[model samples]
Target: MNILQAKVLKSCLNSEEKVLYLPGNLSQFQMALILAESSKFNSFIFANKYETLARDYVNKNSSSKVKFFLTETSVADFLPIIDKVVVFFGAVTPFIINSFGKIILTCLRTRTPLYEVPHGLFQTGQNLVDNSRLINTDSFYDGVGENLPSLTNVKLSWYGENGFGYPRTVLKDAYPARVIPKFTLVTSNTNWFLYSLSDKRMFYKVLFDYAKRNSDEIFIWCPHPAELLPNTLSHSVIEFRPSNLLLYGLHNDIYFYNIESTDDLIPYCEYGISTVSTCLLDYEMHSKRVNIFNCAGVKNLIAAFNHASAFNSSKEISHNAKIINTGMLKNFDALKFDQLLSQEVSKENFIDYNYLAAYV
Candidate 1:
């Protein structure tokens, strides 16, 4: 074994190695197949260790004999115990990149074949490898899927299974919010900063503050799946729902809102708000509102307000919203803001001003 492989193996002690790989966490039902394979292979799937949905799916579907280990287990600890490795998803994420690299080297030294599923081995860009190590990778997703013998015979193809598959809903029974709306906002913790990159956590903190100010409105601050730990759900204005179905169950008038990353919540919000998020594209299929937050500097204030109020300022804001240019500040210079949020702040720190202070 190479030096890196040797190091990884030594840390694994003497346990037999078994591993599985997953491209994405959405394939929760696939755990049955993985667990079945585990009994013969001593394997584990490569995925985010902290993802709640993935773990929950496994726990509910897997037999008691199957062992589910998190990705946090060190390569050294995992390599020695795994007898076979199967990757489940298209490889992405920093954790997967590092862990998979170590595994690749070790497998090369050990002469173990790493099995890849359909679409599991494709690299969309040159980022996956350096020029020297490019030849070994394979992609099942790239094979020509449709063959057309003539102009009339040509068929257009797309990704994902679009059959009339049954939709799975998460069931939760809990006290409903005081005021439920036809449409509500749903944001996750992972992209919390996306609302306002300048002030950290301003996205959520500000939103909570706004909700408190407008407690009469039936606004829901549905926590991201991973953000609903016991400690994270403390808020007064918004009703917290652990299951998206329960949140969706409340009303059909509900609309999903996200700032940037919607890797997980895209499907839940069939009607979406489009801006920077790719998930918004999926929502466009329903022709939902795709309002853009026009003001640039107030990203922090806007994020906080959206999170707390459970209402997007964009709903009230428009391209023609009043604007005033304040003279320059010390370092960042003068700024402009919506009359609603900017009316109170000096030009110098308009963006820096706290929206929560108004709610508190």
Candidate 2:
């Protein structure tokens, strides 16, 4: 074995306590932090490109101690110390699979515990199999297994109850102020995949028409981080990039708020619109007024959210478009949800830690 591989093997043999490694996404990072604070784990490590964001979130919103590390480090340097891994999403990329693949091999050899903490949301067709397209092939596994390290498909859980029960008290304590807008357009880059060039033009055209009709209402457009605003739409409305959206200011004309994580933004908007995104479902759960546009494909995905009034075309957007409500939404009791979540947070150990033990 090479020096790095030898080192990993040695570390796996010597270390009795397991450290929890989490992805650097905001939601996952937050959940992992909570787990670390409430568990007997050795240490909580955040691993990903967004180390700065993870630090900012922990410093501002949480009191738990955490270590932030970049994902680009040498695998030998990083994976040796990690005994367990908690990911909100499946290992879908080569880099992710390779890194975790090494850890899996080490853990398997040592008979140590390792686990994947999947996102709490439920999506059809994703949970039927544990292996992703990139990692499931025999050639990929065969090459990696030569070193006696094998990658096993981590299991997934539809922890939807955990979604409703996120500690609202902690969130309220962290972010005290509320910023609400009269009308908000929740834009997504789904147009990149869901709409053709003409369809995209029509999509925005419908929004522009609606904005023109409701000139008196204060409108704010919130774009997804991956979305690029077309010049046509850019010239008409005030656009805010994700970095500058949360400074708290008032504007007269139609504007965009540049903010990361629309979780906070969606709740405050009186009315909302999006072409197909989880944010729309979030808005629905929170009882916010929102609409989904019907693109050419993704009808089944749209139906999964139980949203009604999929605008077949841009021309269908009229004044009455905002008034339509599909009662198919699943709403949680706000007080009960908060109470259950607070109870979970107050525990010495989170329920997720027990779930993690099951894999070990």
Best by lDDT: 2
lDDT of each: 0.33, 0.46
Would you list the clashing residue pairs of candidate 2?
A: 241-258, 245-258
Lowest-sum lDDT 10-residue window in model 1:
148-157
CA lDDT for candidate 2: 0.46
lDDT by residue (1-360, candidate 1, tens digit) is 111223334452544444444334433324324333434434455545434644664557554334444564555465654554544333233444554555554543453434433221111221122222223223211221222111001111112231111111111111133332343344333322223333223344444454445445444334444343344332321343222222322333243432222323333332332223222223332223433332242233334322211224424422232221111111111111011111222233322222312221
Q: What is the Å distance of residue 270 in model 2 from its true position?
A: 0.7
**Residue range 66-176, candidate 2, lDDT tens digits:** 555555444346655665554444433454455454444444454344444434332222322222234332231211111111122333232244333332223433434
By TM-score, the best candidate is 2
TM-score per prediction, in order, is 0.32, 0.57
